[model samples]
Structure formats: structure tokens, C-alpha cells
Target chain A: MIQDMKPEDIIGDYKETLLDLYGSICRVVLYTDIETPYPDGKLIVSTTDKNGIITHVNKSFVEMSGYTEAELINAPHSILRHPDMPPAAFKDLWDTVNRGEKWQGFVKNLRKDGGYYWVKATVIPNIRHGEVVSYTSVRRKPSRTKVDECIKLYPTLF
Target chain B: MSYLFTVSPDFTPVHLSGWYIFNTWLQRQSGSPIHLEMYNDFPTQRLAIHNDQVDLIFANPFDAAMLVREKGFLPLVKAAGVSDEAIIAVRADSAVEDVAHLSPGITVAVTEDPDVTMMGMIMLEAGDLNAGNVETTIFDTYVLVAKNLLNDSADVGIFLAEAYDDLSSIVKKQLKILVRSQISVIHHSLMVGPKLADRRDEIQALLLSMAEDDKGKDILKSLGFDNWVKVDDEDMEFMIDLMEALAT
Candidate 1:
């Protein structure tokens, strides 16, 4: 039902505010200190409505998030936000795709069981008639060099 | 053995790679070999700078100044004819007319460098707007800042003034500069380490001559500069100011 809205309807100010509130309140389930990086050549894909509520997800995204398809659809994409990811980085991501450009960066995602995974992700605006109505994100296993760089840099950004 | 060459990813790889032609010229000039590296993340770069692995580096003015002051490095040359100014951009149709005109809830886009982004914030504060004058968003590169304004993700964007010529015509047509600043900024610089002290004058002379000839001009233009100029003490004063502000 949410995905069926017109572009203006989709940008409802209340939904943007609600997601921000929801992101602050949500908690992740705790697990051991396991860090599994998705193997090279595998992609985790997901699409969210203009408000960032998940509308479609691929098998890889489901596996990495550790949430079933049923559990993920209609959920806020923030479910995968890792504690280590800086708010500024997300600000950059939103600032990029919202401008109708593709944003590529290193991301650390929180799994359903509270484990963490890192990937190099690119998010692009899905535009129709010059209006962005949704966003599509594809994440892939990050190279060791990028991961090494992120580990040293992310601490300060947070 | 190859000489070590390093450059900061101040500009994006997609827009232009800092090391591309300069590395080739440096290698061809010296002729043993050269290993060039680009470091964008600041922390890792800090470690590398302190490790003494870098023989020569191209970096933003403030960082080059810091390295010269604290790390026993020597300032060599910079791209001539650029003020290295950063500008604040807004949608052509946006109601915001100036810094003071910015209302609450407006978003300001910027590049990720703390020093550069803070410079924009400082100027905004000087315009009588408080810290929360607008939402600031950090992009990985300066070129993308203008894209934020064109797309309506931001009402204002602060980006390198030198890069304005590189924006697509469509995006360029839709934006206007609401503010411009030559203060709190430095152009790019090439600096040499202490190990290369004996060869500094020779290297600087060669690099300067490269920007004067036709073929070398082509290389320089491709690297996003018109010519190379020797760095003088006066050229570093702004960087000193920037360092002081960053320290606080």
C-alpha cells in the first residue's frame, strides 16, 4: 500500500520523521563476536520506498541481514544499520542519492542476530519522470584494503 | 628502487585522479621507477605520513602546511592561477538569497574533510546564523556537493571553486553561488620529504618547467591545473590560520 503512492504522497513529511524516530528507538538482538563478510562476487540487494521502508529484497540481502523475506518487507531499511556506522556517513548517502546520483562507500551492517558484516555499497535513486520515488542499494564484499582503511577511519567518524 | 609518490584523493577518481600524469612525469624524469599511492582516509594517511614511507606527496594546502611545519617536509610547488576558493551553491530557484537568508531546516552539503567542512560552517556562523543554521551533509568528494543542490537534497553546497568548470552543463545551469570564500582554504601543493632535500631544487625546477611547455601543459590540464608555481612563505599563511582553527 505504501509503495503505491504518488511521488508527492510518498514524500509525506510524517513518514520521514517517523523513520528517524524509529531508527533511534530500535534495538538489535545480541550475538557473539562473529564477523562474517559476504564472499566476493555476491551481492546483497534491496529497494526501499522514498521514505526508506523496504519494499523488495534479494536472497543475498535476506541472508546477510539474517531476516526472512516476510520479516524484512515493509520494515525500515535502518534495521541493518550497524552501531559502528557513523551518522555522518548515512547523511552523505542520503545527500547523494537524493540528489539523483549514485553514492558508493564502505558500510558496516547489523544483522538480525546482532552480528556485523562489512560491504562496499552503492545506492542509486530510482527516478521516474525526473522524480525520485525510491532508492536501490546493492552491496558487495569489500576488498581487504578498503576494510583496513575503514577500520582505522570509522572510529573517529562515530 | 622506486621513489615514493603519494597524493590525497581530494578530488574523486571519477572526476580526475591526482596521481595519473604527474606520476608518469615524475617517473619519466627520474627514470629508475616510481610507486604512486593515493590515500583518501585521513587516519591511515596520518600513520603513513609519520612512518617516513612517503618521499613526495601532493596534498591539500592545510595538510601540506601541517606536514611541512611538524614533519620536516619542504613545500615544493602548487598549481598556479587558482585561488583554491570554495563556494556555497544554491538552486537557482531556491528562495535563499544569502547566508542570512537561510532558514531552519535547510540542508548544506559539503565534502568530508573536517577542516574544509568546518571552514564552511565557520563562515556561516559569521553570517549571524548559529551552528544549527542548516543541516550539513558530507559527501566523499567536492564535485558531488553541487549535485546535492541540483537534486534538491540541499539548499546550499560548499565545494572547491576550481572544480566549478567540471560540472555538467545541466547541473551547472540549475545552480547559483550564494556565497564565495577565498579565506580558510589552500590550493593543492606538492611537498618533498627530508630524505629528498638534496634533490629538492632540481626536482622543483624540473616540475616548474614541465608546466611551461606545450606537452607539459597538456599533462597539467589533464590533471586539473593550468601551471605550477613555486610555494612561498606567504602562500602558507592561510594554511597556518586553518591549522589554528582546526586545533580548536
Candidate 2:
């Protein structure tokens, strides 16, 4: 089992490499079903390119997403975007991280085979040399109450 | 997508507009867009820094000194050439010709600007006059100081050496410097947050090369600066010392 730790809990840099065009998100699927609950004390770490392409994922993340390393290595981060997840939530995420600030929110991500999991994720600017080269995200099991609150508020962002 | 570019609120909005060209150029060079921000008060800007709401700032000496000492901000670059100083100017026709000839109780106009205030204080001290010795009127900017001085509201104007340069020609002919500040006037610092430290070399290179580009020359001219050079830590230290003295 991958060590039950946070990304900050992991020592040293988490490496990933995915370079997609800045924007190429066309798939929009919203499933009505709210699926499995992410367990306590588990963190899913992922890194994205400047364009939000999935470049790297930790073992815990891979197991949770049910995608092999090859399936996610160059996919858009939106591949994990869940339908019930509010667009406003992601908008807030972009707004915060775009300003080079860290943003934390409840995210509901989809799996490769149509399963889903909810997490409270923190996105930090991976700034190198006064510029944001990419973003590093660490997601942990979120409380049911907080996820419920976000679920109620997410759709209003659109 | 864009970084907040804050300037001291001590400057009026009209004055703040002067950085548009430079800010745009920086956005292009750094690959980060910029949101222009200015404050009417220093404390508000200080709060933004504490909150990490600012990525870069064009700060006056006093505030810059405080931020550098307190925050982990990196002083990236400064204007390339020309000396920045403060001066005590009198109406050309005034009988008071120099610092030594002035007597106590004469009114002097100065801004609350840290740079102007510090320089004025230093020059006043040199003339054996402190705030107690003179009737001082503090405005928000040196431009206001010059206005009050010309209107006969004050006997002397204490302002930036460059403000005198920007004056209307007729206004220019009406004032003469009675005392120039020898105290090292702190240069403007283009500072970056700690998060940007890794990109220091890239930012510095872009700034240093700004004047070399054809379009950059125009931008620099409009901003009243010639070029940008890597920051000098000695000057940074002096500014810190100045602020420290003020605190004590």
C-alpha cells in the first residue's frame, strides 16, 4: 500500500510531465450517481502541466482513479472532472491558482471506468523562477459535511 | 493568470497610470499577466503583502525598507541611472537664499511620503533645524507641496529632486533649491515575493534587457526611468537603517 501521508507528508519533489495545449476540454459528462466515499487518512497526489494536463500521479492516486499510469500520463486533468462537481468550484480553483496563490476545495473526481471519489484538494502554484511552470495538487479524503456543502454551492458558480 | 502589481497608494491614480507601459512589458517578459493595483494608504498595501495578495510592487523607500526587513521579498531591480534626492526649494524671488540663512519658524511644505520626509529631515538636521524648529505642513505628495509653496501657503517646498524636473516650465523658473539632501535617497525597488525567488535570474535578465529593445526605450521614457539594473544590497541596507532609525 502507498504510505498514508499528505503530499507535504511526502519528502522531496513529486515529479510529473504532461504538456497539452492550454485548453482542449470538450468532453462533458455528468453522471447522476454520487459514488464511493474516499477513506480517511489517504492522500492522492498529482501534478499537472501549465495547460492542466496530467503528467504524474502517485500510487494512491492511480489506485483510486483505477487508471494505469499509461492512461493518465498525458490526459487532461478534466478527465478526472466529475459531472456533479460544480463548474464554479473549478473556476474558483483556477482563479486562486492562476493568481499564484494556493486554493483548497472539495473536488469530486471521476474514475476511468465510471466510478467517482470526493476529496478536499489543495492546488499550489509550482512557481519556478518567478513564473508558474505548472501546478501541484494534493487531495485528501474530505468530510461528508464539507462535500455536502460544496455540492450545494458548486452549481451556482456557473 | 495574472499577478497583482501594486504601487504605493501615496501616488494619485493619475501618477499610478505611469506604470502601464512598464507593467505590460513585464507581463510579456515574465509570461504572467498583471493586475494593476494602487493604494491611497501605506497600511493597506502592507496588509496585502502580509496576506500574500501581492506578487510584485513598485515601492517607495520607506515602505520598501519595511517590507524587505519583515517579509522575504526579493529586491529584484531598480532604475538604471540618475540620482534620486530630496531638496528644499524656495520661490526664486524669496530673500532666503540658502539653508544656513533660514531662521526658525519659517514654514516648509513637504509630503508625508517616506522618501521626502526622511530626506527633508536629514537636510533640516544639517541646517540645525528639526521639526520643532520649523512650521512644517505635510501633504500627500511633493506635487501638492510645490503647489502650497507657490501659493504662499508655505515658505519652502520639500520634495523629490525629480519632481522639480517634472514641473511646468514657468513653475520651474519660480523655485530654487536652498538645500539639497545629501542623505542617500532610497531608489525605487521592483520587488518580488518569495515564491518567485527561483526565477530571480530570469526576471533580472528581462529587466536588464528592457532598455535594449526598441519598444522598451519608449516604455522606459514614459515611466521616467532610463533602464533597470540588478539591485544593490548596500543601498537596500541603508534604507533598512533609515527605517530602523525612524522606528526608534
Candidate 3:
């Protein structure tokens, strides 16, 4: 009989194996039917081309934003942009991502309901053949402390 | 010249010696010229490694894990045995006395690097402290956080213990340690990309042999190290536990 491993043990081994492989990669999955144990957070998965145009946003993105996938598709990923965000931030983000470098920052995004949410986002370039391809992003609700920091900095940047 | 990239917690002249020593050792062993660059922050260093900007870096444990998981970088050696301790600090006269007293309305300053700040947050979350009432400020470095606290801009500050050693006596005197976290597993690890992984045996051999040379000892002393050790997964499991707990 194959013995079942505890979730903690599996997570431990998986993290170490990944560390041994990639130095700074954070694996974040966006879609799921089961509820996540972490409270007050949602995962957003978005794919964009080399120029940062939106190509796909999963069901979770549509559900969380209250926007249809049809509306989101082909739109710039920043369509749901919150007014509080500074353009300089996105400029830095694009500069980094286009270079095929992953950038992590706290972002405030607006939902269709006009309410806003904060995410700790990791944006990475999906590379193929040493050429920049799509950009994949995984975002989760950041700690409230981190969120507050972003809120405080947003007004100054704008 | 072959490029050598390294990420350190900071760019102080004291911390550059390790990379210089390692680079010299690599040059002597492989007969290749090396040019080295070092970054102070974890995120920037990680980005450099991913983009192939740096060939190797001294990474924080979590950053090392992320690189191995996401970018295919190999953890080659545990550079410098120094383990950093994180501490929660407040003004000596502040009303907040314990972990429970940290609420949302209170302002806390943290360094911009997630590795250090997140570890402190994980400990607070595990203790069930009220997070909603806290206002957090993220500065570029602990020195900045210290400046903010001294200027009365923040109610609390989280900093590494070693940072205190670098501060002026007057500034250190104004601060009081509210709590020091349980010993966290953090190390400055040397990591190499896949291109250099094939040289693992040679790399390891050079690192092991460096301590015997007079020039190598100078480099080691400058980096704040007496020796290096071969650390395995078991050595880093505590950090993994902290990351999983924080992720939840």
C-alpha cells in the first residue's frame, strides 16, 4: 500500500524541491472548485502577450470582477484599473515584465461593482525560444499591512 | 570577462568580500576572468537571476526557494553561516507592550523586502493578533524604517538584529525591543543557474579549498564569514514551514 503523506510534509518536500530548481518562483494556482482555507482572498490568473494586452482571464477573474470573460478578453488587462493607482507603477511593471523579468508589487484593482480589492501580484514573462511570449500573473489578497502601505503610496505617486 | 552576479542583504563594503573571494576562487580554478555585481534587496536580486543578469547570488532562504521553484537556479553553497534574527520594536515609551496590543490603527513600518516583513507578519498571524487595525509602511530598507520610527512616523518597526549593530548608539538607544521572534532559519546561500550547474563538483571543490589560501581568507573575513557548510533540505525545512503557514 502506498502510504499517504501529510499535507504539511508534502508541502515541505515540494517547496524544497522547487527551491532546488528555481531560485525565486512562487507557485500560485488560480482556478478551483474547493474553498481555500485562507480567508478574505481570491486568486486571479491572467495572460497577456509580449505587449501586455490581455488574452485570457480565467473564471475566477470574471467572477471576482463581475465582468464577463467576453468583455475582458482582448481588452488591456488594465481596463479594470482603479483610479487610485499611479501610472508610473504600471510603467515600471511593464518595463520589468517586457524584459522577461518577474515583478512583484501590491496592486489595487477595481471590480465591476465599483468596489476595489488589493492583491500581492507576481507577474512573470512566459518565455519561449529565448523570446518573450505571454505574461502570466498570479495574485492573492495581500496582508492588510501591505495593503495599507500601497494605499498610502498610491496618492503620492499619482 | 565572465560575469558573476550575487545578491546580498545589503551593498555595504563589508558584505562585498564574500563575492570577491568566491569570484577569485572560480577564476583561479577555471582560469576564467569574472566580473561581479551585487544587489542589496531580495526581489531585485531574484529578478536579476531570472533574467540571466547575474550568474550567481547570495539569496535569502525563501528567495532561494522561489528561484529553485520558478527559475531553475541551483542552490550551490551556503555562503557565510550568519543567521539573521527578526525583532519587533517600538519606542521605549509606547503603550503597546505585547503582541496582542498590535492592532490596525497602529502604524508599523517594515522593509520593502517581503522575505523579512512576511516572516514577521506570519508570526503575528500565528499568534492571532488583530491585523485589520494595523497601518503598515514599507520603506526601502531597515535604516529607513529606523528613521521613520525616530521621526515619530511609525508606532512600531520590524528589523533584523544585525541591523542594530550598524546603527549609531543614540538611535539604538531610542529603540526598545518589544519581542524577538523564535529563531528563524535564514542563510545567505550562493546559487547558480543551470549553465553553471554542470560545474557543481568543481565549484564545490573550489569553495572547500578557498579557506586554506591567504587571499581567500581576506575575502572571507570581509564578507563576515569564517567558513561555509554543505546544508541540505533538512536545514531549510523551518523556513518552508514558515512560508506555508504564511501562505495559508
Candidate 4:
């Protein structure tokens, strides 16, 4: 009897199912945070097109980078790139992301005041029909040992 | 009497001969024929234990550690001798002369299994090498990693002790050992399920007493055994420390 529903009704039921799935995923996200005390410290989530123009920045990113959403949304992600970072690092990162493999690394980005901070970042390429639609990144504070090691090496790589 | 064993493609003929000797020894000691069933992999052996098909097993140290921690099994004796020598090999022509010289952009090839790869990571941690900077590529086999290094497909390769004998010649001629770790002993152990805890003393006595027999001596010699020693809780503590350290 449920299968005999009208198309509109079926679509509405499908929407509800999707909303339930999304809600379940959100619950999982909340559970993970509760389980670990070392919550992901901060995140700078941004979407970029093929040409690397920034399409979005979450509020956390705006606050962390010391930029408003308006100043960042249309800007290139390189606006925050640290001068001490070697071009080869970004080149390799882009190459990995473009190939649709997730790239993970400790990156140093310059804040608006020219001071720098490090993040352990994972970049995932979003694709549709073999074409990359955008890139998304999740970042968090790395261990102090990790940050210290990268800080000592980053200047030499330039 | 029922016994369990694991068989792998990598098992040498001598390993098979050891099993025969074990079976003969068990029969002589118990005054009855023991039925032996071999599992081809650790997963199957684990399942057999879960299903109550096997009472005892020879498991890899890592697997045995998991079984002990997760299933509360008691380890009886260590079978395979332990060694802590992992090699980080770089091509003869490469610029990396030491672990400190290993640059960020250079690719380091490692074996795919985390059990094997963790040895390299441990060495890296000890050497204060930052893994975040190095490009790490994982191969299914250490030999394949060596081949990749020889072929210039990767800049560095890490090989465990088992792979050393096969890779040494190539390494000496075409590659250099940038780092050699201190020998850390990691033994493969014979384990018994929780059901056999009551019989622990008898089982330990049986294993320790085997060395007194001529047949046991022959089996031990053939299997490269020195002698079976009593295992204590202290012996297992290292494994616990290693597992905890690696988990982080």
C-alpha cells in the first residue's frame, strides 16, 4: 500500500529519508567530538574552482585568517600563503589534489598581521563525472613537536 | 588432542618439518594421537579460535598481542626469534647521506602493512625525522620497494630484518644504508585461549621439558631453536608498551 503513493508523495518521503541520513551523519560528528577531548582545534574550510579562485570560506576560517568572509570569498587562496613556504610544496600539493587523491601535510600560513601558524591539513578533491568541481580542506592544530619540526625546516626550503 | 597452526606461502620447508616434530612430540607425551589442522592465514586462525575449533596457536607477535589484549589469551612460548634491525636504504647516487639529510620532497617507499611500516616510523621518531615533510609511498612487498629504489622510482626504501638477506646484495651495490636501527627483539609466540588457563602449569612444563628428549632436540635443531624458556608477564610487557606507543 505504501508503494502505491503518488510521485509527489514519494519525492517528499525520499526528501525525508535524505534528511534523516544527513541528521544521522551530524549525530556521528557530534559523537566523535564528545568522545575525544582533543577536539579538532580549528578548521579553515574553503572551496576553490579549477583556477584556484576561492569560492567560499566558513566563519571559522574567516576568524582564524583575520579576514572577513567578503575579503576572502572571491580572493585566491594564495593571498594567505606564507613567503617561507617553498613553491615546490604547493606544486606537489596541487598535483596530488588535482589527481583526486587526498593530500595531507603540515602547512604554515601567514595571518593578516604577517605572523604565522601551522595546521595539519587534509585536502580532498570533489569531482563530478571525472571533472574536479571544487576542493575542500579540513585543518586542525598539529602536535607541538610536529609544528616545531616544520618551523625549523620551512625557512630552509625557501 | 586437538592442535591449531597457521601456514603461509612464505613458510619454509623447515617450518613444516618443525610442525611434524611437534606432532610427534605431542603424541609421545600424551600417549595419544593428536589431530592437527592448518590454517592458511591469521584471519582464518582467528576465526577458528572464535568458533572454538582450535585450542592453541602459533601467531605473529602483532596478531598474538591483539589476541591477548582483545580475547584474553595467554601466550605460552615465543617461536620466532626477535630482532630490531630495520634499514633505511637510499640509492648510491642519492643526495641523502643520513636521516637528517632526507629532504621534504623526496619520496620514501615503505611496505604496505602497518605492522611492518611501524618499525620504520619508530626509527623515524627516534631519529627526529619529520614524516610530514617526506613523501611516503607504500608497496605491498619490501622487495618491491627495493626494486623501486633500484629502478629510481623512489628515493628511499625501508626493509625489515626478514627482507635484509634478500636485499643486502642489491643494497650494498646500488644503495646505501642511511640508517640502521638498534636491534629490538620482537618474538612470535605460541598462545592458548582463556579456557586453558587452568592447565597453564602443565602446558608450560610440557613445553619446557621437551628439550630433554632426543626427538625434541632434533626438531628444535631443524627449526633453528636454541631452547624453550619459560615466558613471564614481564616478557609480554614490552609488547604492551610497543602497542600503546604505536597506537598514538
Best candidate per DockQ, number? 3
Where is model 1 more than 4 Å wrong at Cα? Answer: A1-158, B12-18, B130-134, B182-185, B241-248
Q: How close to the true structure is residue B180 of candidate 1, measured as C-alpha lDDT?
A: 62
For each candidate in turn, the interface RMSD (Å) is 19.4, 26.6, 10.1, 13.2
lDDT of 1 by residue, A1-158 (tens): 11111223221121111123234553422333558766433447677888889988877788777778998899878777666677889989888887887788889886665567887777877654467877777665455556878889999985
Q: Select the stronger candidate by TM-score from 1 and 4.
A: 1
Q: Assess every candidate by TM-score.
A: 0.54, 0.55, 0.56, 0.52
What's the alpha carbon RMSD for model 2? 23.1
> Model 1: per-residue lDDT, tens digit, B1-248?
66677876565465345457768878888664767877767666777888878888877665765687678787788877754565667888888776656666777888766555654554454344435556778887656788777777877787766666568788878888766654423466788888887788988888889966787888887776788889855345434433442332
Instruction: Report how far residue B161 has shifted in candidate 1, in Å.
Output: 1.6
Residue B14, model 3, lDDT: 54
* Model 2, global lDDT: 0.69
lDDT by residue (B167-214, candidate 4, tens digit) is: 557456887876665434445566666666676677778887777878
For each candidate, the alpha-carbon lDDT, in order, equals 0.67, 0.69, 0.62, 0.59
Superior by TM-score: candidate 1 or candidate 2: 2
DockQ versus reference, model 3: 0.02
**lDDT by residue for model 2 over B1-248, one digit each (tens)?**
56788876655344455687678888888888778877677778888888988888877777775676667677878877744577778888889775656677888887767666766665554344668888988787667787787889998888777776677788878888776643333567888877676877888889888888889887877777778878855456544543443321
Indicate the residue-level lDDT of A79 in model 4: 57
